[model samples]
Target: MDLVRIGDKVISRHKIDSFLTEILQLRSMGLSQTDVAARLGIDRTLVSRLENMGELRKGKSVAVIGFPIANRDEIYALMQAEGVDYVMLMSESERWDFVRQKSGIELFNAIMELIALAHSYDQVVVIGSGKRIKIIRAALDKEVVGLEIGESPIQEDKYVDPAELVAVIRAIKGGNV
Candidate 1:
């Protein structure tokens, strides 16, 4: 008698199953396979195979990547709604490394470029948190060209209200603020 044991499997098919379900859910909800790949940071071929397997659920727009971590679309959408056109997402370590390699001037220039991209918008919103937020706030205060840093010099006093930031950008560009 020959018996097949699931435990004999080399790879974790469950993970594959999970990935498939997630991809299918995203696809049915109107996300293309390429979009799924971009959000998941994986190849489109993997998503294609999973869709073919029929291991996916019918309709689920959002896939929870290991609980707290979600794909990029949610983050991007949230930023957009918040009126933030200049969104910089980097790790704390990366922020520190950037500051170390480039003088505040160079970093300031790069940030201005990001803000300038929002010319079509009425205002530019910069979304950040933690050390990243602090660094961005500081760069803005230095008159980063496109941004209107708050009147307060103190970091605590410097807050980024999406609406306020937009107002300031409009004023500056329109020569009102």
Candidate 2:
């Protein structure tokens, strides 16, 4: 077996490569920059820098809009960890109640504000059912990556796969899609 000694310890280059692969996997799994840093005994800023390095464009801005997601909070956390500039994530019950309980100008203003906010981003990743995706795309009138997850008004919160979403984002960001 061959080993290289950089200082006091000897290690295989394969081991270093393997460790790097794990770190990237953990990152893909939606672990926060801080959590990855803690796990790797590295600075959190370094993790942030590594993520920024993969960003397709600087200052182009990305946003996420999803609803009725069962794992809304976790998905939101993942978006933040991935460096999305804006997010409007809500569970099914929360979104329904928001509209159902409001009336007159109250509802109108809220709806308008949300739409206005959604239009601010350069690219928006819309996660919803086939039906909702159509509506969202019509309203936003911007670059959208519509990720359909069946149909909605669903009773259960949809559990989104972080890795799948990450792949779509990477493709969009890298201009591959």
Best by lDDT: 2
Worst 10 residues of 2 by lDDT: 50-59
Give candidate 2 regions above 4 Å deviation: 1-59
Residue range 4-75, candidate 1, lDDT tens digits: 347765566677668767877788678999999999899999888865653323221111100011223454
Each model's lDDT comes to 0.47, 0.78
* TM-score on alpha carbons, each prediction: 0.24, 0.62
Q: RMSD to native for every prediction?
A: 19.0, 14.1
* Regions of model 1 farther than 4 Å from truth: 1-74, 77-86, 118-120, 128-177
User: Worst ten-residue run, lDDT, model 1?
Assistant: 60-69
